[model samples]
Target: MNLAFIQNMGGGGIVTILLFSLAYFILWVYCLVDALRSNFKDPNMKLIWVIILLFAHGLGPITYLILGKNSKTTN
Candidate 1:
């Protein structure tokens, strides 16, 4: 994004946006790692979810966290 535009948005808005972005990034990474380490019933399911995470930036991780996490096979 343009740093100039962000600078013009005032302090509180900037802080809130930065914090939300950071939190989102953390959640995305956590979901990616969790998907990688966990076993799924179908081998292709892992690949599918990974692809989803890679492409579907906004909703992919949230959907995985809410729905896909439960679909993993327990050791």
Candidate 2:
């Protein structure tokens, strides 16, 4: 484990980046699980959301949180 990179990041930079990265990962996983568990109007939507989350990285989960969440149908 090379911590030299962290030291070079300068004054809490690595910490800030790590926090944001962790937050993003959690959000992405939550969105991914919700997409898998929830029912959507279109049966194919779950697959689409999953694909987007896996490939689109940052923007994918954010978009799904904003838009895809509302698109789920109540059972």
Candidate 3:
């Protein structure tokens, strides 16, 4: 393998990694915001969800969005 080939491959790999990082960062931030704004009646629940989302990354956010409470109406 020539130095030129290696350099080109490295550059492409870096770009791909950077793009994935950016997307993940944006998703994390969005999930954090959504968890904070969620209506769970308890502040502790919100904090827990936010921390879970941050640590669990993609799966956590989706779980929170799907299972979290809806504060639109009271029973």
Candidate 4:
């Protein structure tokens, strides 16, 4: 609830934060790269995904991964 409480938790909070940040970073990078390489039916979709990944933080990449893919591909 307070700074002292967080401090008393020692490395747990710091480790958790670091781990979450790392995971988010990895996910973001993966999504960005995938979006860049993806073949969208509409070329504008690539730009849209890039913009979303840039400004939407954790949710943007997720949205792209979930909904931005070209469904025509089997891979």
> Native-vs-model 1 lDDT?
0.91
Off by over 4 Å in 2: 1-7
Best by lDDT: 1
- Model 3 C-alpha lDDT per residue in residues 1-75, reported as the tens digit of each score: 455755767777878889998987887788788767656765578778877987887588677667665632233
- lDDT (CA) per prediction: 0.91, 0.90, 0.72, 0.82
In the order shown, the candidates' Cα RMSDs to the true structure are 1.9, 2.6, 5.2, 3.2
lDDT of 2 at 31: 91
For 1-75, candidate 2 gives per-residue lDDT tens digits of 778887778968977998989988899899999999999999899999999999999699989989997788977
The 10 consecutive residues of candidate 1 with the worst lDDT sum are 1-10
Regions of candidate 4 where Cα sits further than 4 Å from its true position: 1-6, 70-75
Evaluated at residue 23, the lDDT of candidate 1 is: 96
Estimated TM-score per prediction? 0.87, 0.84, 0.62, 0.80
lDDT of 2 at 73: 93
Candidate number that wins on TM-score, 1 or 3: 1
Total clashing residue pairs per candidate?
Answer: 0, 0, 0, 0
46 in model 1: Cα distance from truth in Å?
0.6
Candidate 4, 1-75: lDDT as tens digits: 457777776898889989999999999999999888877777687888889999999599788778877532444
Clashing pairs in 3: none
Q: How well is each residue in 5-68 modelled by candidate 1, as lDDT tens digits? A: 8768999998899999999999999999989998999899899999999999989998998889
